[model samples]
Target: MGLFILCFLTTGGALDYLYFDAFTPSGPTLPAATLFSLGAASMITLAAYHGGGSLILGSLGAERPDTQIPEHRELRNIVTEMALASGAAMPQVYVIYDPAPNALATGTNDKNSAICVTTGLLALLDREETQGVVAHEMSHIRNEDILLMTMVSILLGGIAILADLGRRGFYSPRAGQRLGRKTPLLLLPLSLLIGLAPLIGRILSMAVSRQREYLADATAAQYTRNPVGLARALEKIRDAAIPFRGATRGTAHLFFTSPLRRRLENSDSRLAHLLTTHPPINRRIELLYRMAGIMRPPVQNTRNASTRSA
Candidate 1:
């Protein structure tokens, strides 16, 4: 929904400026504006949701599981079991060669989805914990979180890119002529909006990511019938203390936990909390423990452990 609205706003804003310059001094005809806004927004939404998954996978160096290997076969089987439990179609599976204990899901919808896990995830977690992580990723597919997140990430990047271009265009001599001297007022407001859209879009996207992560965690507990499994998996992940070599802040929100090591691990400041893509690790573990009818206190030094072997 936020993605759709941002798309409409950015596209509509562009159209309005074009129409104002080309067709009428006032603005484009209402009917034309409406039609163009809807059309552009629809196209962008589809492109972001449908094509964005492959872009993400490629950027992260994820590849289809090498099914001939016993370990790859086991991973595929786990994904299939979780998908069946969730009543979602089996999704394509990928393996990230990185030695970080993390996994993420992608694709536009359940039928089109893919799941990728790091080699370290498979190496470090035992069967039950691996199942728990797979269940968590499957829950994201079942709830359509992958589609929303992939689209949001693309849209946020688009907002930033377009805003930069708009700023450059605004300062051009052609732009000065396009908006007459009397319309300098219009230029100021438009420029400010274009500059701010990226920052605003990023904050909103991060908030959405956090909320969806919480929901996916709960759904994973339901699907696995074992919140403790996920809780332990998270503990193992936290204890590893290794940064995901492939992770950038752009795709951090997609992972089972924040993929960067110690980036925001100890910050409890309100601003840091709000900017984080995932809820605090221990907080997430506590919620899972609650689901399992346990009330364990958060361990204070979960992030201090040495990096685990892959």
Candidate 2:
């Protein structure tokens, strides 16, 4: 939240400078513009949380399971068991009819929460692996990670919107010379600052998101007492390399894996990783294996005989 506020303030400051120095002579000065920007940011954040669940699911084309079939019943049962284990309400479950294997949890609170998974996930994962994925999402609900991610997403959107508006208004052919004509000394610095605000904010947001994912992984392991299940689920997701068709930059953070192209995970660039919401799959699997007191899972199901210790 601090990062969100800081990014908002920085972007607001740039916008204020642009208005006073370039856009309109009578435009809201620094103080008034700041207030307006703050109000806008507040509205965006409130709307995000107000009907956030519906907005998220609707954006992803998610549908409530018909619940008439045996398979759907089993899916609901897994959710019920995980919700019990995580001490959260049995959140409404929805299905996305995509070929990508992924899932997410969202709501303003535990009682209002919903979990959505793709058809691909159901087709790909075994019972234990499915339990692990469900447990990981439930952990997000337990930790209110959904709320945190939603907040970040709103702020990121605000920053991007503000930055884009500032750039277009400042750089348009008619106004491109406005800054230079009026404030020769400030044009370059201001332009650079305004341009970089969105990128910087996105990077910080993704870094925080990656950390939360690690914590969720740990918590899921604790709840299920079977880190290997999630480990295997993640491995499968990595190998499948199918992107969720419905995911966009706005909702990508909600997914268990990156919903962008498979090549995103393949990038070895340090800068590329910072902009991604998830840590590398292999690193996550290694941590889960460590949590399970095994360096790595054996070729076979050696851990299958071990039950989840109460």
Candidate 3:
């Protein structure tokens, strides 16, 4: 859904660009989407390597020309092992000094993506659980879901910053100087639109994130050879109230669970749950259980990873 939206927005922008070329009114012309896609793709593909390294240890209420990863040794090793087992690119790893039990992967694409985890999370789960978390994120990497998600995040974030500037334009002394009466009228609707736009974008973004999560969970189950362990890991994170201290909403969806949130008690409700990025915990557990039928593996849990994974 987010990929579609990103393409749609870029399409809209490209159309705006092409409409200006109407003066030529030439015969065969490229669609707006093609040009927009090329521009966005070129940016990601060209700058991915540098961007990935820079973002790997960027701002977390600190300053460093080049910040060194805190737990580089273990995290990097686990990630490398997971990538090898899965036959995927070894995602770069970073640690947030924050005391929240959460982790996330971010980048323009697989080539440039960075995985970040808070110190709190490092302290929270055991190595197997950590492996499950890493495996899940790797699935995202393998599935190529990062491109659309990263685009949606950048677009929505820009829209928000632009909207805020638009709002400030009204009160700033520069308002009358830069924005004429026509400008205010123009910004009025645009501001309202931007304010609400991220909400809608998030819904769609979460929808895309949700599906990737299910697939990743299935993938983790396959790799770990113990659906029960992965499920148990999720259960611990879900039940733990240790909020990930510094996880901004900008990258929260990349975590193993809702890293900063406690499990919703009413999480089972149908209507509200639809809005969540992850499938319901019960749904995830149930899906893991069904894996037995699909993958035909041994069940380990005394009760059931299905019932408890939730």
Where in model 2 is the C-alpha error above 4 Å?
22-32, 171-177, 182-185, 262-269, 297-310
Candidate 2 lDDT by residue in tens digits, 228-282 = 9999998788777788888877667788888885445545479668778787666
lDDT of 2: 0.79
lDDT by residue (tens digit), candidate 3, 168-233:
545777555533523345445544554555566566667777778888899887777767666656
Candidate-wise lDDT, in order: 0.78, 0.79, 0.59
Better of 1 and 3 by lDDT: 1
lDDT at 75, model 3: 69
By TM-score: ranked, best first: 2, 1, 3
**lDDT per residue (tens digit) for residues 106-156 in model 1:** 998998899999999999998889999999999999888898888876666
**Per-model TM-score versus the true fold:** 0.83, 0.87, 0.67
Evaluate model 1: give its TM-score.
0.83
lDDT of 3: 0.59
Regions of candidate 1 where Cα sits further than 4 Å from its true position? 2-4, 7-40, 170-189, 265-269, 302-310
Please give the clash total of every predicted structure, in order: 0, 0, 2
